[model samples]
Target: MIIGVALGMMAALLAAVEVTATVRPDVVIGLVIGVPGVLGMLMILMSSRRWVTAVGAMILAIGPGWFGALTAIQVASGV
Candidate 1:
């Protein structure tokens, strides 16, 4: 549970940094950081662990996952 929480916090912090970094320039680098952030968030949610941790991860992932999925959709659609 503690490990899960730590991962969730790390994922959230990574996403925050990615979002801030990508605000205007160096989009590719920002996306690179964000991809792992989103993946880590999903990993936390998908793994069968303590229910409390799972719920915490779910909450932690929502923002980053939403933005990442939205970007993925746009990029794929553009291609």
Candidate 2:
């Protein structure tokens, strides 16, 4: 539960850091896209109940999660 959320957040941060180091992305992009993305993932991972997960997932899907995911994808795809 809590552990999962913590791990997810850490993973997101680490991935973001790696991307930042490798890609040298703009500072704004890292904050705007990376931070929220990781935080959204944390929110989603923190969900222990079904309803909570649903809400978190929705929040993630709405924007932040995609931002985070896209940031990662950008690195992977070399875009």
Candidate 3:
């Protein structure tokens, strides 16, 4: 749960920053629409039982992490 939340927060920051200057519309759209839902789902799953909560958080984290990574790459490469 901790790891998931940490990673998710980190990714969200990256995505948010990327959204500010990124030319890719999809990246902006995904971060705008998908991230909040994923984070909300992660928060909701915090109340679930043991393994379920952990799995849920991780799953939610991974989804947006990819877009964040892509955006980060674009920012890094100045593409």
Prediction 1 TM-score vs. true: 0.29
For model 2, what is the error of residue 31's alpha carbon versus the real structure, in angstroms, after optimal superposition?
A: 1.8
**lDDT: the better of candidates 1 and 2:** 2
Q: Model 1 segments beyond 4 Å from truth?
A: 1-54
Candidate 2 has its poorest 10 consecutive residues by lDDT at 58-67
Candidate 2 structure quality by residue, lDDT tens digits, 1-79: 4443444455556666675555445764566555646666887788788877765654444344434554666689787
* Candidate 1 lDDT over residue span 12-36, tens digit each: 4566546654354356446544554
Off by over 4 Å in 2: 1-25, 62-79
Best by TM-score: 3
Best lDDT among the predictions, by candidate number: 3
* Distance from true location, Cα of 78 in model 3, Å: 2.3
